[model samples]
Target chain A: MIILNILFAIAWMALNNAYTPVDFVAGLLFGFLVIIVSRRVLTREPLSLQSWFTFSARRNYPLLVWRWAAFIVFGFWSIVKANIVMARIVLSPQLRLQPGIIAIPLDITSEIGITILSNLITLTPGTVALDVSSDRKTLYLHAMDARDPDALRRETKQEFERRVMELLP
Target chain B: MSLLEIVTLALTALGVLFIFLSSVGLIRLPDVYTRVHASGKSATLGVVGVLLGVAVYYVDLRVALEMLALIVFFFITAPVAAHMLDRAAYLTGVKPVAGTAPDDLEGAYNRETRSLR
Candidate 1:
C-alpha cells in the first residue's frame, strides 16, 4: 500500500507535466523520508488499506469529474467577469473599492468538499475564503467589492455549494 | 505593445497587486486568527493570479497543467493549515469575538459520551 501510494504520487506529479528523472528520484527519496518520519511521528495504529482506499475512492473519482466540469464552466465565466471588474478598477481615475469579509454558511461536511469550495472562491476574481468555523460549517470569505453581504452569501450558497453538493456523493 | 502583451502586463500587474495587498493584510490585520485569514486566502489567489498571467503569456499545455496542479495543491493545504491553527487557538483559549454566541463544540466536549473510537 505504501509503495502504491508512492507510485500514485509519482503518477500525479507526472500528470502535472513537471516530472523529470531528477524529480522522480527526488520523489522516491521523499517517499522514503516520509515513511521514516511517519514511522516515528505516527504512534497511532496503522490504517487499513480498505479504510484508505475506500476513503480516497469515495472522495475523489466521479465527484472530481463533476466538479471539474462545474469548475471549467464557472471558472471561465468568473475569470472573464473578474477581468472586466479588475480592468474597471485599473482604468478608473477614481478607485471605488468596497472590500469586506462576509461570512458564508456552507452545507458540505466533508473536508475535501470544503477545501474545493474555498479554493474555488479564491480562484475566482475578487473573493477569498478567509476563514472557516471550527466546525467547518461556515466559511468567511473576503470579497473585493462586496456591497451586499447577504446577497453574496446567497449567491455563494446557490452557485458554489449547490453545485458542490451535486458533485459529492 | 501588442494586444496580447498589454493583456499579459495587465494580469501581471493585478497579480502583483494581489500579492502586495495580501502582504499588507498579513501585517495590518489584528490577531493571529485574522492574519491567517489574510495570508492563506490572499496568498493562494495571488499565486494563482501570477500563474494565470504566466499561462496567458506562455500559452503552453504543460505550463497550464502545472499551474492547475499548483492551484489544487494550494487549495487543499491552505484550509487544513487553517483548521489546525484554529484548533490550536481554541486549545489555547483564544477568545472569539465579544458578541459571539454559544459554541456548539462546548457540548460535544462536555458530554460524557460513549467512545466512538
Candidate 2:
C-alpha cells in the first residue's frame, strides 16, 4: 500500500538521523526497493512487482489525494460565492427568485460518487438534490433560481460534477 | 495584538455577520424551499468562517491541520443534514410559492409508491 511505503520511508529516515528532502526521497527509494523485492515473500503468492506498479499507477492514489484537497478548497470558495448569492436574494427588496424542481442528468455511475456530487450540489445556495432517478441516470434537485436550466446544467457539469468525477475516478 | 490575530478577529466577525444574515433570510424568505436555501447555505459558510477563525487563532501546525479536517468534515455533514431536511420536506408534499414553475420532476415521482419513474 502507498501508506505502507511512505511509513517505511519515514522509518528509514528516522533511523538514519538525516532529516532532509533528499534524504527522505532516498529513503523512499530504498523502501520501495525492499517492497519490490520482498512483495511475493510477504504475500506468500506469485505476485509480479510490475503488475502491482501498474495497478498503483492506474489508480493514482497520491494524485487522488491532491485532487480531493484541491476540490475541498475550490468547494469552499464556491460555497462562499453561493452564500453571497443567498445574501443577495434574501436582502433584495423585490424577491425575484424562480424556485423549481429540475432534474439534471448524472455522469457519475458509482453510488458513492453520485452521493458526493449530490451533497456538494446541496451545499450550493440555489440547488438542493431532492432525489435520484430509479435508473440512476438523472438527479432531480430543487433550484432556488432556475432562470436558465440549461446554463445551470452546463455549469454543474463543468464545475462541481467534473471535480467530483476526477476525485472519485 | 498581531496580524494573525487581526485576521482571526475579522473572520470571526464575518462569521457572526453571516449567521445574522442567515437568520434574517429565514425570516424574509417566503416558503419552505427558499427558506431552506437561505438558512442551509449561509449557515454553513457562517460556521466555516468561525471554525477557520479558531484555526487561525491557534497558529499551530497540528491545530491548523486538525481544524482543516474538521472544516471538511463539517462541510460534508452539514449539507447532508440540510439535504435530508429538504428531501423530507418535499416528500411530505410541502407547497412552494406561487411562481415556482417548470417542474420537470412533477410526474417523475410516484408519491404513492415513493419511487421514481
TM-score of chain B in each prediction:
0.73, 0.89
lDDT of 1 by residue, A19-136 (tens): 7656766766566555444532332434664443443433343345456676778855664465444444444566454555566667899887887787667555666565566667
Docking class of 1: incorrect
RMSD of each: 11.9, 5.1
TM-score of 2: 0.79
Looking at candidate 2 chain A, the ten consecutive residues that score lowest on lDDT are A54-63
Candidate 1 pairs with clashing backbones: none
Among these predictions, the greatest DockQ belongs to 2
lDDT agreement with native, every candidate: 0.60, 0.80
Where in model 1 is the C-alpha error above 4 Å?
A: A1-68, A71-160, B97-117
Q: Using lDDT as the measure, which candidate wins?
A: 2
For candidate 2, write residues B20-113 as lDDT tens digits.
8999999998888778787778988888889889989998767877888888788778777777777677678877788887687766777887
Q: Residues A1-169, candidate 2, lDDT per residue (tens digit)?
A: 4676788889988999888767878887788677666655554544675655554432444455567679877877779888998888778898787888887888889999998998889887589887788889998888998888888889888988888988664
Colliding pairs, model 2 = none
